[model samples]
Target: MKAVLGPFVPSYTGPWLAGVDEVGRGPLAGDVVAAAVILAPDRPIEGLNDSKQLTEKRRELLFEEIQGSAAAWCIARASVAEIDRLNILQASLLAMTRAVQGLARAPEHVLVDGNRLPQWEYSAEAVVKGDSRHPAISAASILAKVARDREMVAFDEQYPGYGFAGHKGYPTKTHLAALEKLGVTPIHRTSYAPVRERIEQIELF
Candidate 1:
């Protein structure tokens, strides 16, 4: 995929281009995590792919490798409450902007995964599957996924019944059953359809 995308072909023609991606967008709980990673143009990491395609162990290994290889990297999050307040799209963009702003070195160009680029000062291009095609984007995806997963795991320890560690806040059957049994927790996203429906049903009864 990298070869097909021509990562070496220099899409932005900038020396310092940062790629950004976010994770936990579809989850019913937890913050949306965004990461921005700038790679040294000359030292590209091999075997980079969309983080979703990789196993947890592989993603963790790549996350560590990216930390070492990137010229600059940062992760940021928009809380679940913020997501409810601003809406997910806006919250996600805010998280991306925060991640980029946190970077030590300012990026000359930004390559964002998915179609919409945040309203930011930097010039950017949005590629639909940038994470698989761009090294920096792939790095960012890994960082965001790993960070969010870790956060969900910690939430599992705190919440005790939701299986957050197992499903990472995704709306799985186990998660839904837990929600039905336990009612909503502070961590649950009330704005999400499943959660809202559950709440309404419980309220009626």
Candidate 2:
């Protein structure tokens, strides 16, 4: 598939353009993680794709390679408290902005994976499905996904029985069942309907 697909082409070929992407917007728990990556024109890595399209093993492999090869990369997140306060879309944009701003080298332009660009000083374009089409965005997606997945795995160990490691805090059948039996945790976004309903149930009890 990769051979037929060939390599990803950047929308803008500027030396310092960064790609930004966020993960964990739909999950009932955990922070919204985002990543920004500035790819070195001279140092290109293979197998870049939308994180969702790649296998866990492939994503993990690319995750390491991206960090090593990219000109600049940073991972950032908006906490559950921030998510509850600002709402998911805004929180996602906030996380993306933080990721971009946290980059070791400032970006000349940013290509974001979604249609909405965060309110920031840097020049940026929101390319719908940019992850599959652009190399830097693909790298950002992989990094954000891997980082958030690892954190969810850790949270699973800390909280237990919620299946966070498996579901990654998505409102899966197992996660919903666990929420009913084990109740919400500190990492859960209370503003989400399922979590909020669970809290209400507890309050009534």
Candidate 3:
């Protein structure tokens, strides 16, 4: 689909606007991932949208198409340790900054898919729900979400029973139950209230 470009989204001939988005901030385990996508002026991928709005199959399809068509794309992450050390918002912004820095080419402007912009040198704007308003931001959201979901699947293999693959470490009923039964894993964010409560419960008992 043609991008839902708006006031915040640039329609310039130059494909120099990099869109950034992050995923996994709410997860009690694993890292926060972010992606920056600079879409090509000549190449337009139909059905580009917010990753959360797309089905898994559609996201995977667009993920591949985005890889082949985008002018530049990069994925980066702040680990669980960083999440605990820096708070989720700061950690998410850090991941976004890294994603932008890791891009193959520098962007003239950055559009992030949220209300707050990271502290970065680049000219940037924070758009509320930019993922649905801008194609590049949508692409970035897909990449970050898909990449982090895949990481959670891998984490499931290493740390079974937490249902990382299913819930992706979110504070689901199953995940909280597992945390109570199994105690906190090293990947779990101890700074989180639920995880901390579980840890305290274990220590108390």
Candidate 4:
């Protein structure tokens, strides 16, 4: 038999391959959301890039395009309660796993946009900064970010002074100050240091 060599190819470029990415991991409130997308080889979407690199308006536009063009796509989340119980990292992985499993059909391979892969049965690879490099991952990133941002905007109406609309549940100075002055809301992650400190202070009184 003759030895043969072939050029390496990224699995995400293959059929039935999914790219996964998450958003809202650093936020002090709201769930960590993840999205999985299996892009159609024939239907190439233009301007796919890291969701953070794009404006909100651009992401919104791409979000629709991805949904309409992808062969399979799903968005899933780990709640604040899950984050507190399992820790943020584990919860994020869980969210990603859920997103992959939620696809209309199982992916032959999964490319995750981070250094770690979730513990799951699917064949997967972890690609650092994959969102910028892979179209599927970028699509996933846009979906996760837009979904989570919209949720936080809705939370702003319910929580009022916390500025969830502006900060999107991140631990901004305004958010920290609101936590101290207005007290921790139910959406706030109690496992986080700032929220835990507030809870302790309330317990002492």
Candidate 5:
């Protein structure tokens, strides 16, 4: 791993550097949500780590704190229709791009949490597992995860029996069984293999 200057490190780059991350790539339903966060020099948030590594309660706490502390932050998403039209990977990237663009102020540079940088105009760098390595990216990851999870929970209410609240729209056994029983919903990503197969099966029968 290469060293970088971030708030987590002593050689802090100014808050102009925004960190970007996205969630919901593997979900069979809902949108791919992304977030960009710029942590100010004055606010140094602790417990900044990968969202996946934290408990749901911890992530929820961090999500709110990050919003309150960050100099600027934005959350954006590519809708289910957009996910079907554009591939998931592309849609995820597009969500991240939109997040950065939607920030309160444009960043001088961006540190993306994945290995692949989005098709973006701003100066950017991709850090593998950056959510764990960079505080700002971790903040973005927490925000994105919390936001998407809330959406899935809400979708569970709207589209009952799919267990969106529990599985968060992942291709879990419960979700697959629900799809088999309840059929696909409007939020389901028809482009995904599992969802597509179910759709094909439904069409045949």
Candidate 6:
């Protein structure tokens, strides 16, 4: 993991290099939440890699450490309705922009995951596997993922049959089966394929 963090070492790079990442993009329900994290150059963290590579316990531990260590950090979300309105790509961009804008100190440079950059005024770079390569991006990934998971767990309590705690709103087979049995809920993305198909079937019936 140290080797992964080497290239992104902040040494005199600027006041900050904010790394941004989002979670819940592919979920059939729930908001897309993005996190922007600015790590202090002098105090780099160890065991920082892509969030998906870590266990849930490890991610929770890192989430606390990041909250304490970061110079500026924030998470923002675009709701399911917004995702339907803007499409996932644009909604994710909106969520990222909100996360960056919410930061107490504006970053000199923005490092984002994936190929496309957001329309923010700040100078930015998009790395294909940034969450694995960049420390700040990895940290943001953990924050966003952990935060979204917690929200899904809570939703599971409210909507008992959906199994949100298990699949976290993704289109797993169990989730698809549940949709077929229970039908659409308010939290579901009406624009998504699975939900749309179910709606059409009901309409035809």
Winning candidate number (lDDT): 2
In model 4, the clashing pairs are none
* TM-score to true structure, per model: 0.93, 0.95, 0.94, 0.94, 0.93, 0.93
lDDT of 1 at 70: 83
lDDT score, candidate 4, position 108: 93
lDDT by residue (161-204, candidate 1, tens digit) is 99999999999999999998998988888899999998999989
Off by over 4 Å in 4: 1-12
**Residues 1-205, model 2: lDDT tens digits:** 5344444465567899999999999999999999999999999899899999999999999999999999999999999999999999999999999999999999999999888988989888898788888889999999999999999999999999999999999999999999999998999999999999999999997
Any runs in candidate 1 off by more than 4 Å, and if so which? 1-10
Tens-digit per-residue lDDT, 163-189, candidate 3: 999999999999998888888888999
Backbone clash tally (model 2): 0
Tens digit of per-residue lDDT, candidate 6, span 68-169: 889999999999999999999999999999999999999998999888889879888887788988888999999999999999999999888999999999
lDDT to native, each model? 0.90, 0.94, 0.91, 0.93, 0.91, 0.91
lDDT value for model 5: 0.91
RMSD of 2: 3.1
lDDT of 5 by residue, 103-204 (tens): 999998899987798876888888877888888899999999999999999998999999999999999999999999999999999999988999899889
Kindly report which residue stretches of model 2 are placed more than 4 angstroms away from their true locations once superposed: 1-11
Clashes of each: 0, 0, 2, 0, 0, 0
lDDT score of residue 96 within candidate 5: 96
Residue 114, candidate 2: how far off, in angstroms? 0.7
Better of 4 and 5 by lDDT: 4
lDDT of 6 at 200: 92
